[model samples]
Structures are given as C-alpha cells and as structure tokens.
Target: MSLPPSYLPAGGPDPDGAAAGKRTYGPDFLTALFQNPLDPGYSDAAARRATEGRRTGWRRGLAGGSSALTLVVIGFLLVVAYRQTVAEEPARTKARDSLIAQVQNRREGTERLRAQADRLGDEVAALRERALGGAAIAELKDLEAATGMAPVRGSGARIRLVDGPTSVDAVTGERRTDGLVKDTDLQLAANALWEAGAEAIMINGQRLTATSRIRQAGEAILVDIRPVASPYELTAIGPDELAEDFRAGYAGPYFETLQGRYGISFEAAEVKDVTLEAATEFKLRSAAPSIAPAPSGSASSSGPGSPAPGSSTEGGR
Candidate 1:
C-alpha cells in the first residue's frame, strides 16, 4: 500500500522502502483513541485500550467532589481570618459617638448647676446685705475682694500660650508631644504671673482663686476641674508693666527654653482694661471668731470712763 502524496516528504518516499519515514506525531493518535465503535478494529481490546486513556466515571466523580470540598474549606478559612483580623469599625465608631454624647450631656448639666449656684449665691449676698447694714456690707466687699469673689478690671497683661505646630522629625521620624501644652506649663505660667505681681488672674475665662486647681487629666488641661483647650488665653489684672515684668522674670528664661526646645508658643501683651469675673464662692468648712479675748480687769467702756453707763461713784463723793 502507498501512503498519500501529502504524507510523503519533499523528495517522496522510497519506491520499495522497507520502513516509512519516521511518522510525524500528529492528531491521528488521538483520533484512533476515540474512534467510534462501528469503526474497523473496534474490538474488546481496542475498547479496553481507549478506556485507559480516559478517567473512569467513579474517579471523575471523586475528583470533582474533592475539588468542590477544597474550595469550600478555603472559603470558610478566608472568612474566619477576615473576621479575626478586621475590627468591626462601624460598631466601634458608634460606641465612640455614644461616649462623646454622654460627656457633652454631663458637661451641660454641670454648667446648668453652676449657673444656678451662682444665681443663688447672688440672691443670698443681696439678702445678707439688706439684713446686715452698711458696716457689714463694707466688710463683705472687702472679703469679696480678698477671696476673688468680685470681678476686677484694670490695666494688666494678657498671656497667650498655644500648642506648637505638629511635625515629624525628618531624621528620627518621631512624633513629638512636647509641642502640646501641658497642665504643668499652665500652672508654672500662672505662678509666674502671680510672682510678677498679678493681682488677679484668669485662665481661659475661668477665674483663678486660692482654691482653683490647674492640673492635667489625660490629654486635657483642667482649670478648676473644668477642661480648657488651647490656645489658652490667660488674663491678669495688675500693674501696666506686668507683661514686661513677666518677661524679665524667671518665666522669660523658662519660656525661652520651652520655645527653643519644645516649640511651645508664649506671648504677653499689656492691655488697658482686662476684666475677670468673680470666682465661685467657696463654702467655709470651719471657722471661729479671730478676735482675742479682752484682758481681765480691762473696762469695756467706749473710752476712758468717767463712770459705767448705769453706775455712779456716789460712794467716793
């Protein structure tokens, strides 16, 4: 039998060659494997050999089931990992918002109470003045001035302290908290103002009395237990040279150091009239008359007595 001309090489096959040119591997092998049952040589042996080329139905089913199971397990693991790693941001945000609302509500309530207390104190003072007469009224005025319970207005200085610019160090890549104003800084500033002869000082509009406390609560600066944010505006009523005096005092070198080292901002200016509101009246916890007892045998007469008011020296006469 002769092979087709197309199958032969360019030179054509040898006329009586014992063997054909190396059969170039082609689609014929696959075609033979899948030949129809009606084709020649489709005997049991051919059927068995063709069956070997393809997977059995049971093996195909098992492989498909395994692949599906693997995919399901991978999906489940991915879901678990996502849940474990990613926080529920929405819930956290909601909680944070709720806490802020609560704090605001409490602050509002506190302010309302403070205002009520101030009004009540004013009423009490008015009543006392009406009942006690002019001498008592003058005494009360002096007491108010001494206790910082009277608003004061005079030529003084205004000191402004602000948080410095937030920046990252180029070389170190470290975030600095020094730029943020601290309670200690405020306390020191107030002390400096006092030392500089500040008669009255107020921080962020809160009058500072003898009992006022300036301290830190976490990241907030608290003045008299009230949180005050920067830039803190501290006003003091004193001599016109108060600002200059403060600049000349220890505060000068201290603030300079802060500005140079930590970048804290400090500014002081003289003002014609800076007013500070009265501080809340402090309730006396304990008190007693400060007057000492008169000496024994000393007469309580108004002056060098001619006689006692109701007695006479008739016996001597």
Candidate 2:
C-alpha cells in the first residue's frame, strides 16, 4: 500500500521517479552530523564497553580509582621536584660564583709570578755577564738565542692565521668544525717555515724551543700547556729570502687550500725589527752549570757564566 508523503525524503525526486531510480542524494552534511553526532563504529564500541562495565562493575570502579591515584601521585612528584629545584638554586648559584672568583684570583697570582720570574732572570743574566766576559760569554749568548732562551730582534717573516666563522648545517643541525684553526695546521705551517730556512719561530709571541709543545686541549690550542687565543701570529727570524721562499714553496699552496676549503685566513710576509719573547724556562733544583778550569795554566777564564757545551744547567728543563 502507498505511504503518506511525509514518509518520503523531502526536496528530492520520489523513489518511484525515473531520476530517483538512477541516483540518490542524502540529507545535508550539517543536518546529518547534527542528527547523529557520534560515528556508528564509536557508538558500537561505547555500547560494548558499557555492557562489559556492567558485567564487571567492581573491577571497573577499582581501575578508575587506580588511575586517579596514579595521576595524583604524578602531580605530587612534579610539585616536589619543583620545590627541590627552587630550594637548591641558591646553593648552585653560590657555588658557581665561588668557582669564578677562585679562577680569577689564581689567574692574577700566576701573572704576578711570571712577572717576578722574568725580573729575577734578568738580574741573574746581568750578574753572569759581569762575572764571565769575552768569547765564553759571547758563545753562551749565541746558544741562548739559538735555543729560544732569550728574546731576539731582527728581520723575519710573519705568518698570520685566523679562525673562520663557524656555521651550522641547515639540514643536519650539526656545527662545522673545519672552519676552526687546529694545532696540526699550526704545526704544518711551522714545519713549512722551518723547511724554508727559518732559524727561530714564535707563535703569538711564545717562542718555539726543543721542548715546546703545540697541542689542543678541548676547544683551545695550547703551546707548552699555555693556551693561546685565535688569530695566531707566527714570527720567524730567517734569511732575506725567507718570505719569498715560503710563499713559493708547499706552504703557500696548502694555505690556499685551507682558505678555499675551510675558510681559514692566512697571510705571510717579511717584517723588519720584529721581537719575539723567550720561552718559559723550566728549572731543575739539582742541575748546575759545569765550569771548565781553562786550559792547563791559562788564567782560569772568568767564572762560570753559562753551562759548558754539553753540560747541564738549572734551566735545562
């Protein structure tokens, strides 16, 4: 039998109509969503859960209580941790300040000691020069200059190296280290200079001696355990052809590679009247200068000004 018109879908072709037989359109999306806010699957799952809850009513209540207790415990732990951190902040701050102060004081003390040592060394040298005069003193002075035990002034080549700007990879978020100047680079440059006939060399005023060390400690480069800052300047005393020879040799090309590949800055040129400082002397308590009694009966040449060739001295270390 035919039903009432109200039972049919509104604003669309009748089901018995030919167009309705070909295709059908549902209610508007907003209207449908308002009518059934919950999805069919979610409704089914909720029904199943309700039925299971009814079956195990006591267990469901216990689980809910356990969850609430766990949340409460976690909140309490968070509160306690925040309180502890707040309480310890002052102590941590105080400790950090104390450490900074100590470091500053120690650095100042070290500077004072270094200055005092330099003064004493000058006084000792003067006394020795007065006691021993002539060829022996001259020879000793030559040895001192050769061994980097004393400062010297003359014409030489100056090499300057500077660290490049550090950049991070945009894709990988990794800091690039190749741009920074390394100890090996300094060593290579020094060797290159030496090969080109450099007699004496200094890095940022620190003289390079037989016992001198160039190494890296963490992020800093050190010469003889003393840290040197970036933009290292190397002064090498050598023949007149030193600068030209160095630039024409392997060093020039290698430095160019560094500049192109790593962005490090390099410069080499000849400089006049450049003075370099002496290396820090390491003294031994038991070491002493050996004095030769001058040939057979010869006037016992002055006193011991310096250690005889191949003999040990206080600052041998």
Candidate 3:
C-alpha cells in the first residue's frame, strides 16, 4: 500500500509536492537533548574557527597578557590597602591616647578649681556673718539652707535607677528603648521627690536647685551641664514618711511599669543621716534704692521727682 503524501518517510518530498529536501526536527527540549545537545551558535562558531585556522600567536599572547595584568593590578591594590591599614593603626591609637590624657588633665584642673571656690565661699560666708547682726545672720542662714545653697544632713529617701537589658522583642520584632533611662525620667523622679515634701535633694552628689537643669546631650545625661553616668543615684532629705510618700506618688507606678514591662532597675529606700551637698550656682533677684532720699526741708519737692526703688527709669528711652 502506498503511504499518504503527508506521511512520507524521512528525507522524502515535501507534503505539497515540492523538491525533495532533508527532514528537520524543530529544536525543542527532547530533540536538542537526544539528537543535537550542543547549541547551534557554538557549533557554527567552532566550524568558522576551524575554517579560519587557530588564532595567531601574538593575539593569543595578548589575551593571556591582559588577564595576567588584571590579576597583578588587583593583587597590588590589596597589598597597598593592607599596608595602609597597618601604618595608620598606630597613629589612630596615639590620637586616642592623647585625647584620654587631655580629658584626665582637664578633669583634675576642674576639681582643683572647685575646691578653691568652695574655700572662698566659706570665707565669704564667715565674713558676711561677722558684718551682719545676729538677726540678719540667722535669716540669711535659713534662706541659704532652704534655697539649697548650704549642705544639710538628715533622714531621707534614696532612689536608684539603671538601664535595662538591650534586646529586640522576639514576637514583635521591635527594639524597645523603654529600657533606657532618659533625662525626662530623672526629671520626673526629682519632681516626684519634691512633691513628696523633700526639703533637699541631690542627684549623683550634684545638688538640685531651682535653677539647676537635667538634660540629655547625645547618649549622656547632664545635670547642670555636668555629665552623670548610669546607675543614677538620687538622695532626698525629708521627713520620716519620705519613702512612703514617694512610692505613693505617680513616679512609683511609672517606675513599676518600667521594671515589669521593660526590665529597668528601680529601687527606693529610707535612711537616716543622709547628707546632701550645696548647689554651686544660685540665681537671686535683689532690689536696692535707685535714688537718695531728699533732705528734710526738700521732702515735699521730692515726691514726684523720686522714682520707686527697683523701678527702671529707662522705660521710654
């Protein structure tokens, strides 16, 4: 039986009865895998190279030389970087040591100055007491004590706070700063002590006055521009109920939350014979007579002419 035109054998005439031609299979996955695995472009390139003969020796040498030059340049750059790092290490270390030494020297100088100032302050106080009357001296001493200008010793409460562990929450995938103590936290703690009727307070030995500032500069906490590091210790002089009152205040529950939720360390206790130092700075508003009183005969003429004490006469100007 004769086969149909469309079902002709391999290397047969086309189905449309055109000239006889080689039968071809499209380059699908199975055809490429079993019949011709090499890519057609690579096969063509190989045949072309064979017809043209091998590359000239100089060209081959040029390709190999280019690769070798690239490797050499990369190796040189790596060596230079390593040597530069080694050479700069000592310089960096020396600069760090110099800065540390300067810091130590400045700190020692500051301490010496502070001691001298304290001695001068004591001398001034003694001279002032000798110049003023007994009543005036008593009033001045009371004022100084109340205004945190003079150190005092008494029963009081001590509060300590410290930073908690730094960690990311496993479930929430959030890093919490609640564990860190901030300037605001100390401010709140101080305010709470004041609210609890504390007569005098000191934070890390720095007296807390009305004009004193508790603030943050970068990661460090500053009290009156002096950096105070953690585990912050706060001392408050007050009555017997100082600790109880502080714990009842808002700062108590606030600290409790920090301890429970954020792992912050907070502690408070009452103790006797707590001593707080005087503040180094104080701001006072004073008034003095701006003009001398008139003579007895000219008293009536001075009524309108004499300005009140402490009143500025430069208002209009």
Candidate 4:
C-alpha cells in the first residue's frame, strides 16, 4: 500500500531526546509510525538474546540470595554456639576455683593442727613425768601420817548447791523454796574453804579459777559461774587444823545454825589428793588486740595506735 510521506520518521536525536521531556512520544511524524504494528522479523535474534539474558540474570539473582541466606544461618548458629561456650566456661572455672580453695585451706589447717598436736604431746609427757611420783607421794604421806589422818584418793566428796528448800512458813507447807540453799550460803562456804587454803575448788565438775564468779540458778547457788545442784559439799586440802579452825570459826557455826533453823541436813567427807583440771579457754572473735588494717591508698604511718598489735602497750591489770 502507498504510505503518505508525512508518515516517515525524522529528526532522530540523542538516546534521551531532549524534546521527549514531559512527554514519552514526540509530537511529530515519528510518533505516528510507532502507532502501527511492527513486522514479524523485526526483532528475531534480539528478542531471543534479551529473553536469555533475563533468564540468566534471574538465576544469578537467585544464587546470590541463597548464598546470603546460608551465610546468615551460619552466623546465627555460630553466635548460639559461642554463647553456650561462654555460659559453660564460668561454671567450670568456678567449680575448679572452689575446689582449689578448699584443698588449700585444708592443707594449711592440717599443718597448724599437726604442729599443735605435737606440742601437746610433749607437754603431756613432761606433765606425766612431773606428776606426784613415789617421792612426792612420800612427802605428802608423811605429812598426813604426822597429822594422824590417812591420805585418800580415787574418790572424794563433791558438794553441789541444789535448789533451795521449800517452806510453807514452816507451818503452812504452801511451798516456798526460799528456805533452800541460797547464793550467800554457797559463797560463805566457798570463802571459808578458800580462806582455809583449798588447793582446788569446783562447781558441777568445773574447776573454779581465780577469775571465777558465783551466781544463782533457780533455787540453787552456782559456784564459779558453773550451775550446780543441791547440798553443796565443799572440800579443802590443808593442815587439818587450819581446815577445822576455819570451819569452826565460820561454816561450822553457819551450818549448825541453819540446820537447826531449817531442819536441813549437813554432812562432810574428809579426803586427800583431790585432782582438778584447768578449764579450756576460748579465743574472743570480736576483741582484737591490734588495730585493723586501714583503708586502701592511705598513708603508711596512718594515725597513731591505728589498731595494729601492741597499740595499747598497756600494762597488765
């Protein structure tokens, strides 16, 4: 068919035609030719190349996305594994450190105790050697023989201040234990024995020392801070005359008077060779002989008497 001359494309320009701005197609003859259908052979090889290029590009894009996903999954797994290792490490370290500390402490304690035990063994052997040997016993036996009294041992009389006696006004029987042994009575007896030269005094099997203090427990009189129960039998080892004289001057009179007034029993057991052991002394935790360590970054001289040992330097009481 014959086409009009005006239908021919013209004025072809740059890749992005300047006149194409604001409008996709130009207002000229070229714009009218594209409105018609294209020939079937126009884009045979170019169309194939374009379709294959698109397929290849899509495949490359899919491969890149899969690689990125794999990397992310691996990173996540690595993070989880690292966290698990971190979590397990501290516990293992803690257990190891604790076991080490325990072993170290036990070793140190054992060493100290072994040293103390060896010292105690030596002390015990020396004490056994120094104990009243046959010679020492001879001196004591001679003294007793001259005094006309046989020396006794193995067992002796033990006095205990039990609860006081109950008194119903001595007639009412309403039960008033005020008549029972009192602290004053026990103290008087203990004082009499001490003044009479008691070698050893105890209450409830507890040895009374110089620092001992007597107290009351219920109706009973406790000697040397050790609670004892009933009929306190005090003993003294000395010249039988001194013991007798001391009691005749004090306890004898008191016991006789109290016995008659309260109808309480009074008895005595004279024996020799009474044995008493020393008390166990405990360390005081709160009391520090030396000043405590000062805070960090402080002057070495610190303040005078800064809680170090020998700070007090005071003479004994």
Candidate 5:
C-alpha cells in the first residue's frame, strides 16, 4: 500500500492490479498467469472450465480414433467375405448344372426306350420293306437275343470334331456352327469312311450306328454315349492313304481353311476294323420305323444303310 504502484516491463502490465480491477477471463487469464505466478486465482471459474475442456478434448480424440479402428476392422471383414463368396459361386453353379444334365439325360434315354417299345410292330413292318425277309429277319432275331450278352467295342476308327467357329477371321463372314461341334461334321467324316468302305465308326468313345446322331451338349459333342472334341481324327481301316488323299483334296482343304482361323488339329489313320457291339437303343426319326418291313417299294433305306456322300453339321466344340 506504501508508495505508488511499481513499474511493469515495457510490454507488460501490472498483473495484481489487472486482476484486482475486474474478473478478467479467457485469453487474458492465461496472459496474466505467465506474467505473474504470484497472482491469486483471480478467474477461478475460468480456470476450472479450461481444465474440463482439456479433459473433454482428450476423451473425444480417443473416441474418434477408436471409432476409426472399428470401422476398418468391419471393412476388412466384409472384403474377405466378398472374395470368398465370389470364388465359390462358379464351382457351385457347375456342380448344380452337372447334376441337372445327368438327370435330364437319364430321363431322355428312358423315354426313348419306352417309345421304341410302343412302336415295335410298326418298326418291324418297315424292316420288312427294306431287306427284312429271310436273312434280315433272322439277323434281327439273333441281334435281339444277343442284347446285353456282353459289351463288344466293334472295330472302327474314332472320329472327333472340335469347337471351330464360323470364320476364325472376324472379318471373313463365313458360316460356322457357333464354336460347337456339329452333328453334320461327325456325319460327314463318318460318311467318308463308309464311302472309303469303312465297316463302322466311333466318335469320341461312343459308337455310331445306324441311328446315332451327333448332339451338342454344353461344351461337348456327343456321338451316341461318347463325347468328341475338335480337329476331329477319323480312322478307317480301308484306307489311311485313301481317306487322307480324299479329305486332303476335298473336306481336308476346307478344314485347313477353317482351322487356319481357329487353330485345330486334323488327323486320320487306318486300323483293323473296330469291334463295337450293336447300340443298346436306336432312335428312328423318319416316318418309316427302321425295324418295320419296307412300305412296299419305298426305296432302300436312307437310314444307316445309306451314307451321305456330302452334308454334315459344322463343329466348334
């Protein structure tokens, strides 16, 4: 109380006096503390509020960091789940498709057998017109008796056809069988063998008899029960050189032109006659039932008995 107030530094003001003057707070409080530590708690409420604010800031920071970590973990889990799901989807679809196909084929085969049984009389009548009398009828009876006696893989060459699209050249604009093996292709190859005097033919592992038709299923070309694929190799016992020379000149060149685009391999060989048993079932399509005697002067069967010198399905698969 003594003399007058003391002098403060050049940039400083009298701290005690400043506090005593009013309840100064906010930035001013921090300023006052640094200036004079001796000063009393002039802004006690403000001091308490600052302390609480600092604690709340730290707590909020921790909460935000924790939240971010949790989100990251959840995201990681979701990504893993998504990958696993994608990987398993195709396998499951393929398995399901395979099961469905098997079931359908078995059903179709069963139905075909039933139809044959129903039309037995008509089939025999058609056969009579063909060469069904005497020796032919006798052969039929023998064949029927021999059914399921044993599985005999007859002498024949394995003819195969693979997936070759229309024009391998995207620009050629040629007609192709959609990258799927065609019934026509198999038929043609087999026909060539027959023309070359082939006794029998097998496509893939399946035996091709009078009634077998090449069918496309999924990615396969079915010859009866056997499946065949591209750049088909057809074997005939009569002539390796003959078949090669024939196709090399006719279908062979055409095949090379086509394969030049798709890249398939074609080969033919001569072997001993393959011994394949008669097909367990035959599919008769014409109005003429194959087993029936010929309808009085209907002409020789254009059935298995006749081979098309030309004309067959194109192949891709």
Candidate 6:
C-alpha cells in the first residue's frame, strides 16, 4: 500500500520511486516539521529564550568589566608601593644631605662669630690695659680674680667621679638609678674644693664662679645651665696639700658613703701645674668701697659756749 500524493508536499519524496527505501527521522526533525507556527506558546518561548541569551551576555560583560577594574586597581597599588619603597630612597637621601650641609654651614658661621668675638674682647682688654696705670691694673687683676674672669695655674688636685655600673635589685628585680651621679654630688665636691683653699676650680672645662649654679634637669646634671656628662673631671688650682685637705673634708666621707651604699665611683689625686680657665661671663649685683669713715671730733676740745659747725644758736636756748 502507498500513501496518497496529497499527503506529501510539492517536490516531496515519491513512495513508488525506485530510490525510495526504509528511512528514519529524528524526533527533533519530526517535531520541527509538524510544529504549529501560529501557536501563542511558541512565540512566548522564543521571546524567553532571546531574553535569557541577552541576560547571559550582559552578565559576562559585567564580569569582564569587574575583572578589568580589579586588575587596574591592583596595578595602580603596585606602582604606588614601588614608588614608596624603591624610588623614594634617592629623594630622602638628597633631603638628608641638604640638612647636613645646612648644619655644617651653621656650625662654620658660629665658629666665625666666636672667633670675631674673641678678637674684639682681646682688643678691648688691650685698650683697657693701656688706659689704666699699674695700680689700676693691679686692682683690676684682683677684681678679675674675685669675679672668676681670670684664668689661674698652680699645684692642686684633680677629682674624678663616674656613674657606677648598672645593677639589678635583688629584692625588686628592678634597675637602680641611685648609682648615677647627680648635681648635688658635683656641688658638694666643688664646695669641698673651695673650703680646702682651692684658688680656682673647673669642672668639665667650665669655670665655677660665685654665681655658678649646679642643678638637675630630668636625668641630666647642669652646671651654669649647661648639661654635663660623666665621667666628670674637676680640676682645682691650689697648694700641693689640697688633695689631703679634700680627703679630710666632709665630701670625702660623703663620697665614701655613696660608694659603699650606691656604688658611685670617685678618685682624687694631687697634680702639679694645673690650669683652670676663666668663666665666660660674670654679672655684678652689688659692690662697695673698702675705705673707713672719718673719726668724729671730740666734744672736750670744743668750748661749752661755742656753737657747733653748721648750727644756728637762736637766743640763749
């Protein structure tokens, strides 16, 4: 049996043809061939498929843009880090060199100014010596000595005080600050030298005047408001027996106590031809002449009836 020709479309396969044989078709092909083109569901399905493809494309584009943005951000951060770590070294080195040069220049300027001041001071001293005679010069010398403005040299003693080695406390397991040298220690040592007939005294090249102050500022010891560090070298100009006198003074026993209790180090030795520099500056607060007043006239030498000098005798009262 053969199917009617009306069942096939134009130019379709002929069932009676010699080339006709048993043939098979896939389900997708048959579905497409028999599909209804005007169905509402088909149109809706096509629109849904198109929308899904567009959404997938949009998601892929968004993901690619985000990845590109992340890569750009990462690259920018790497550049900034490289500049900070590698490129900034030369710039910092240049700035440091500039600062060092400025400091050196300032130091040179200070040195020049100091030299000029010293020359001017010398000239003034020379002029003063020329203006004043021998007696005036002697008086000036005495004044200079009293004011600590003149350097002195003589046989005297040198005392050295140093901070003790750092030690941990056995009881508290804490570092002790008592072994450090302090301002009071320096003051006591200087006072002891003065009492021992020391004519001149210098600590760390700074001369001690009557107005000189030794004090503590935080952890530092300041002499004349200038900081000083250990080991302190105190040079005094006096007689050869100055060291012996100092050894017998209160400072010696105090220092011994400090050594025994706090472990402070101290040493004193007699030195010959010791020189002490004069103080840099001096200020006078009060001064007076040493002359005595004239004696008053005796009352017995004047007559009882005589009027006193510059006195007015009115009537007989």
RMSD in Å for candidate 4, one decimal? Answer: 28.6
Q: How many backbone clashes does candidate 3 have?
A: 0
TM-score of each: 0.50, 0.52, 0.52, 0.39, 0.39, 0.59
TM-score of 1: 0.50
Clashes of each: 0, 0, 0, 12, 45, 0
For residues 115-143, what per-residue lDDT tens digits would candidate 2 score against the true structure?
99989989997889888977778999888
| Model 5 residue 115 CA deviation in Å | 26
Of the two candidates 5 and 6, the one with more favorable lDDT, higher being better, is 6
- Between 2 and 5, whose TM-score is larger? 2
Task: Please give the distance, in angstroms, between residue 314's alpha carbon in candidate 1 and its true position after superposition.
Answer: 78
Q: Residue-wise lDDT of candidate 5 within 162-199, one digit each (tens)? A: 56544554687655545544555565566566665554
Worst 10 residues of 3 by lDDT: 299-308
Error of 5 at 40 (Å): 36
- Write the residue-wise lDDT of candidate 4 on 1-317 in tens digits: 64244443355433565544432334575665677456556677678767766445778899889999999999999999999999999999999999999999999999999999979978974675579676776786555432323333332433333332555666775676545766566555666665565545554555544445566566545554457666555544455454556546666677666666665566555555675444434222453355788789764421111223333211110
Q: How close is candidate 2 to the true structure, as a TM-score?
A: 0.52
Model 6 per-residue lDDT tens digits across residues 1-317? 65555444346775576445534443464576678546778888899878765446778899889999999999999999997878889998999999999999999999999999999999998898899977898899877875688977778999999987777999999886778887767776887787788777888988888667777787798878788899988888887899988988887888887787777788999999767778876676897875875568643211111222443222111
Task: Give RMSD to native, each candidate.
Answer: 23.0, 15.4, 15.2, 28.6, 18.8, 27.2
Local lDDT at 244 for model 6:
88
Decide which is better by lDDT, 1 or 6.
6
Top candidate by TM-score? 6
Worst 10 residues of 1 by lDDT: 301-310
lDDT of 1 by residue, 1-317 (tens): 87675576446566676446644343465676687535565576588778786666998899899999999999999999899656676788889999999999999999999999989999998899899999989988877765677888788999898887777878999875667877766766777787788888888888887667776677788877788998998898888899999889877777777777767788989989667888864555776765998999875532111222444222111
lDDT of 4: 0.56
lDDT digits (tens) for residues 1-317 of candidate 3:
76555456456655676644544444667866888777789988899889997777998899889999999999999999999999999999999999999999999999999999989989997898889978999998777777788888899899999988887889999886657887777877887787788888888988887567777686788888888988998898888998888888888888888788778799999989977878875665774665986777652311111222443322111
- In model 2, the number of clashes is 0
